[model samples]
Structure formats: C-alpha cells, structure tokens
Target: MKKILYLFLIFLHFSCADAQTFDGSWKGEVNVSGQKLLLVFNLKKDSNANWVGTFESPMQTSLKFPINTIKTHEDSISMDVKAIGLSYTGYLDRDKDVMKGVMKQGNFESAMILVRSENEQSGLSRKQDVFPPYDYIEQDVSFQNAKGNASLAGTLTYPKGGGSFSAVILVNGSGQQNRDSEVFGHRPFKVLADHLSKNGFAVLRYDDRGIGGSKGEVNLATTIDFASDANAAVDFLSKQQMVKTGKIGIIGHSEGALIAEIVAAENDKVNYIALLSGPVLKGDSLLILQSYALGKVAGLSEPALEANKLNNRKLYDILLRDEPPKVLAESLEKELIRQNNGNALTSDMKVKLSPMLIPWFKTFLRIDPAYYLKQVKVPVFASFGGKDIQVPANENIYALQRLHLNTTDVTIKDYPNLNHLFQNAQTGKIEEYFENQESFNEQLMDDLTKWLKLKTK
Candidate 1:
C-alpha cells in the first residue's frame, strides 16, 4: 500500500518556489524505527534571488527539490514545497544559524530543525551506484504470452568461470517495480544478483512487463497473468547454456512470492522455490493486519484506529459478495465519509482506491496458498520478518505449516529485527523506510545460499 508520507514527499518536491535567499548547507535528524536518521539540505540563492535546494539522506545523492514559497523578514525565513506535498512553516533564529519549523505531510505532521554545516556533505550518492563490484551484461529480452506482448529487461550476472552454473530468477512484489524493485534509493534485486552470481549462481532478474525498459500494460494484467511472465523467465533460463537447465528455480519476494508459487505449481521446469515474506492467508486478512500495525506504529488514536478497522472489515464483507467494482467503489467511498467526514482521504486516495482495491482484493481474497503449495513437487523454503507490518509472520508461518505438501522440505525462518524489505531496524514503521540504507540481512542471505548449494548437490 502507498503511504501518505510518500505522496506528501512527492508533493513537496514539485511545489512552486517564491523569492527568498537561502545560501548554506543545513542538517537535521529525526527518530525513526528507534534510530536517529540524518537528513541534509543544501540551499543556494540564485541570481534571481530564488532559493533552490536539494534534499539528501545519508549515503544518497542530493535530489533537487524546489520550494514553492520562501519568505524572509530580517533573520526570520520560511519555505514550503506544495508540489513536494510538504510544507515547512517555521522561523529563523536571531543569529540566522538555525531554521526551526513544522513539516506537514498529508494528515501527519512533525517538527523539523535545520542547523548550518561548515563542511561539504559526504556519503550522498545514488543507491544504484552501491551495487557490489561485478562484471555483468545488461540485456533487453521479450516473450509472448496469453496476456499479449510482454517483455523483460535486466542485468544477467555470471560467475568468473564460463562453465554452466546453477541459476535463479528474481520475482518482485506488488507495484510497478523496475528490474531491481528500486525503492528509497535501494535496489535489493541488483544487490542479490551480484552476491549470488559471485557465489556461482547464475541469476536472471527482469523488469515487470510495464516497468523499466520492459513492454506491456501492468494495470491490465492479473497475478495469474504475472505468473505467465515468470514462467517465460524460467523457460528462458532453461535454454541458457551457462545455466544448468534442470537446476533453475525462483526467489520471489512478497506478492512475487505468491506468483512464484503459482508458476512452480504449473511448471515442471522449475526445480526449487523460495518465498521471502510471502503471505499464506487471504488477502483481506493480510490488509487488516497491515493496517492495524501501521496505525499502531504511527500512534493513531483508539477511535480512529477502530474506525479504520471497522471500515476495512465492511469493505471485505462487500468484496466477499463479489459485487461489481463500481458498486464496491461507491460503497467504500460512502463508508470512508461516514468514518471521517470525507476528510480522511485526499484526492490521490480516492483516485488510487478504486483501481487498486477491486481487482487486487477480488483475486487475493479468493487465493488459497495451499492450493498451489500442494501441487508443487519441487523443494520450497519460506521466510518472514518477525517485525513485518505488511505481512504477519505467525499467520503466514502457520499457513505454510498446514500445507499438504511435504513439510520436511519446507523451512520457515523469522528475522526479529528485519523489516519488509529485509533491512534491519529497531522498529517497523513505514515512514522510517526511506531513512536507512537498502540492504538485505546477511544471515538470511547466508542461509539461502547454503540451501541452494545443498539442493543443487
């Protein structure tokens, strides 16, 4: 689910800028997920006296962002990025060395402080540039399926030697993720590809049909339709001379994990499967848990949290009836208004809800993970983060245990400190997502490598 903070950040970035003189590097910090994250801002005054600035997180490049309006009265100054979906209403101190203000993003608001910095900021670069050093060939490939013309584009990493190697295909979770499922300046798939390839496993990861350089409309496709794309990837891997034909498998994360299950159930060519934070429960239940957790983390009031839960349950009830999308959308809007007087959602919320809610909920609510799990003849391994707010670990693990398939070959491990993206953090708040470096847990990666080695042998 897209969080309000993300939308606000986008809005704040594109807002119009007004005249003001801002000419210095400033630094600030916020406590997120129990750890303090450093945020740096560099503002410069142009010849036109317009203030231009860039926002930078630690170890990420400064991204150019415009201020919608800037006002300076003596030493007191203020700026706002209405386009970035963020507004800063604050005052500069008498000494002009500090700017203290409040930042409002959607319904959430917090205080912010900026202090002048004397030295040039370091450790700020694009996340893609952090990929482990490796030699690889980038390629654009396409294949046809029942879902119309579909294409795949990604980097194919190979080991130092030229001999045939064990291979794995990467599958991303929900949303229109690129080949790397890039988020918060991190490319987990690219990191995984480098690490696995260097360890002698040929890896094939590609952009979703409509993402990156790939072709096709993702909105028109369903999960089953996506499974076809994964199937095509498996077929492509099987035909590769450098990939052991009978040894190719899949490693899917979140929603992609479910797609992997469907592919493995239907295809004999796939030899092994790994589910990273895959859900075993129905889609509606998963959403409820996710909503509840997020609300708790954000310190939502009891009445507000209960209202959300009730509305979600009501929405699920309507979905179970398999009503028309239009009717369901109307009903959901009515319910939202009843709960929060139409003030609960922004325009973006209303626009995104219909398309995202109907089809996804319909398919997900009807899916039974065991149906696919029971049909899989290949070995399977699954893992979830104990602190995952998106997918409950206990519920998913219990469902996996109940599968009729050979439980002996199924392994479930939970990392207590990891978040949905497999990064270690003290808390699992979604807003803290962009605050940290993007990297997978070392222990989980080690365990997966070991299991793959054993399976190939």
Candidate 2:
C-alpha cells in the first residue's frame, strides 16, 4: 500500500558548510537492497533564531515534509517528525564539515551522515513524459463530490475520432496525488491515460479531492470519503455524451485499487474494475509483509527484524480497539513504552504513534478488502508487480486468488519485472522508483488496454 504509503526508510548523512549556523541544504544517501536513495534536510533560522527545517528524500517525493522544532545543544542537533514518531539526532563533526547520526523510526535505525548539497536536481523527467502531437483529445473536467463537499478536477482523454467509448476513472494511491499521480518526476498516470485514450478507450484521471484543482478537506477524511468522491466521478461519467451508458469502470493503483473495489461494489453504474498493483490483504497484514520485505532488503539483522514485527503486531492490536479517543491514546502510549523495554516514551515515539490515532490509520488497521471485493458483482482485472515490495504480488495475488468473487471475469496477471508503479525495474526498491526514467512500461499498458477494451462498452 506504499506511496506501502507508510514506511520510507532514511539512511542519512549531513553535509553542510562550516558556518556558525545550520542554515543551508544538507544531503545524504542510504543504500536499500543495493539501490541508492538520496535524503536531504533544508534548514534555516527563524526570526526567533530557532532552527526549523524540512526532511526530504528527493527520490521519494512523498517522503518530504517539515520536521518538528529543532533543538540543538552545544554541538548536538536533533529533530523529529512527530506525526510518525521518527527522529534524527546528530552532532557536528566540525573538522570534517559534516554531521553524523542515525535516522530512527519505529524499531529501526540507520547510520546517517549529512553534507552540503551541491546543486541537486529535483525534477526528473521520463522519456514517456513527451508532450504535444498527441493523437487523442484531452479535456479538463470537474465533478461534484456533493456528499463530501468537494469538486474533483481531472483530465478526460479519448480517441480523437472515436464515436463513443466506455469510460474508466483512474484513482490515485496513497499520498496527495494529482491527476498525473506523479511521484519522483514520474507521471505514470499521464502516460497510462494517453496510452488508453489513443487506443480507443476513454480514460479519466483525476486529482484526489483536496489535490490539484480538486477542492476538499483531506486531513480528516479516510478511504471511505475518497470512495464517495469516486462514486461522484462515476455519476459525472455516466452523464457524459461520449460515454456509453452503464459502461463506466474504475482502475486504481495501490490504495486506489482497494478503493476501486469499494466503488464498484457500491455503485451500480460501475460495470467492472481493474486493480493495478492493488493490495488485497488486510491493512495490518500487508504492512507486516511490507515491513519484512523492506527490512530484509535494508540488511536488518534477523533478531532486529523479528523484534520489529513483534512491535508492529502489538501496535496494530492496540490500534484495532474501538475505545474512546482518550483511552486509546493512553493505552497505545503505554504499549509503545512497554515495547521499548519499559522505557519512557521518547519525543519521537509520541510523534510517531500520533498517526495511529488518526481516522485513516485506525480505519486501515482492521478494514478487510474482502468485504468489498466479495460484493463486486462485475468483471474484475488485477495485475501485480513481481518485485513490488510495497504490495508484493506473492502476498496480494494469492490473497485475491483465494477469494471467490461474485463475478466471473476475475482476470489477474503478474508481471515478473515490474514494480508497484508498473514500471520496468531492476530491484523495484524506492531508490529505483526515484531513479527510473520510464514513466510506465509500454507492453503492460498495451496488455491493460487490451483487457480494458473487452470490459468496456
């Protein structure tokens, strides 16, 4: 379920000028499964002379966000992303013009170094991101998610000369994604939309309600709310003149794939659904698998891996309780301390466990995809990336295959070399996702469209 949409491993090193203050860009790299991922920290002094900054992994766009108020003592520096209970503590190596430390989150920590960034580039372009001379028609459109009080903005693409065609709504996975569903400069959604549009299938790729031109409040909403917006898109598509009646379907990736099932099962107008790198396991189960895979690749020792798993299972168990908010917070905090061998909860631990109390993470803990998948009484198509550590094909595909869906056309395929984003990958690590230039695989697009062509009106 990455953006699993949760874990972004940071192996950092601090590089900065030997200035009196930490007032510049810093960078580092952590090797995950033999892939290099770049990390950055941008620090500046506020009017109060307090140091504040943001943590960034340029390769993983979703990993960039502001850290908590930084506290420095003598030559020591510290910062935490309180929401996820992750923290960085370092001490200046003035002689070496660097800072050395560890990036800690959950039960894992990695050696960190920070150095001055020498004009690092942020925008990575892909070969398939080519513009103009398109053989299709593209239109900007918006629809009302009346129930959620939002407007869903998106691009509608279809064959230029096709009389009429079936329509498919593309849903984004985790994180705040636009219609392009871009990450690390890759616009797979745009590439996929164009491919489908040019191949006689109409594709509607939209911004998440609060993203891009769409309007809504995302902070308090969970997957259920997003499903409502998708249903609204279905309503809008059904009314389009070029769309065949009752021929609307949805194609979702990652968390979006789980969502597509929800919309399909509940919305009668949806004739079919296609899940691209979708997660079928329960949220907690998927996270467990994701953790093991990532830990293995990060070269975590066996004892450390097992300990982390034990902690996660305990955390999920605590999260699944339907107690009052106050009660849950106390219980969860206690569990965290106990998990830390009865030590008091650290500032980072408090920050990290805070997300577990939110609407989305809480809902994700116990919600089972089968509840919706079994209700989907329409054709289904699902594909997985053989190397997708986030939502590994072996785990999810097997889970999906075990389910006897309500419909018959339950087509599922696993591409041996693809990642969660459906790009051709070497190791399919986060590093690869940030480094690869291919937005999407052409061959997979063809296969997906070929399947979609038959499912459409």
User: What TM-score against the true fold does each predicted structure earn?
Assistant: 0.73, 0.77
lDDT of 2 by residue, 105-172 (tens): 78767655665533444445588995878898889998898898988889998877657788899998
Estimate, for each residue in 204-293, the C-alpha lDDT of model 1 and write its tens digit. Answer: 888777656677755556677778888988887888888886898899998889999999998989999999988788666777767766
With candidate 1 superimposed using the best TM-score fit, by how many Å does residue 216's alpha carbon deviate from the native?
0.8
Compute the lDDT for candidate 1.
Answer: 0.67
| Candidate 1 weakest ten by summed lDDT | 6-15
TM-score of 1: 0.73
Report the poorest 10 consecutive residues by lDDT, candidate 2.
7-16
lDDT of 1 at 267: 91
